[model samples]
Target: MGFFDLKAECAICNKQVGLHRFQIANKEWVCPECFKKCGFTAMTPIKTMTASQVQAALQEKEKSAEALKTFVATKKSDHF
Candidate 1:
């Protein structure tokens, strides 16, 4: 048997897009032309966070926690 072929047209541009360049979104085969017209592009896949960035974020979180603790202590003393 021959290879099965899937034909699909773009929603916005209505152009026939090959299987390789097609993407499924919202239960439809989104072609490149329609994707560009809709201002949607494939995101560049990357790692979540680097070591230094994670450390910096954790430091900021600690600083915020300290500030919140100080605020709670002052508010408790004010009511007493």
Candidate 2:
């Protein structure tokens, strides 16, 4: 009793892809076969980074901000 819907149609071929066997293309549901024939590849992975990379970048920015804060705090007044 674990049925699912599969009535979604492919955008390029205008064919039913059965929901579980299709990919998204330009906001339209497309069958995998047609997706390949259109020379499209998923860019989600390449556009995003891993958690560790994001963490390291955030830490580096924090360190730079702390350095700037200390530098400004200990500065000797040139006027007055």
Which residue pairs does candidate 1 place in steric collision? none
Give candidate 1's whole-model lDDT: 0.46
The best candidate in terms of lDDT: 2
Q: Could you give the C-alpha RMSD of every candidate to the true structure, in order shown?
A: 16.0, 15.6
- Once fitted onto the true fold, the runs of candidate 1 whose alpha carbons sit more than 4 angstroms away are 1-4, 44-80
Give one digit per residue, the lDDT tens place, for model 1 in 9-61.
54435577666444343334545554443333456111233334333544666
lDDT of each: 0.46, 0.51
* Model 2: residue 34 alpha-carbon error in angstroms: 1.1
For model 2, the run of ten residues with the poorest summed lDDT: 45-54
| Model 2 lDDT, full chain set | 0.51
How far in Å is the alpha carbon of 69 misplaced in model 2? 63
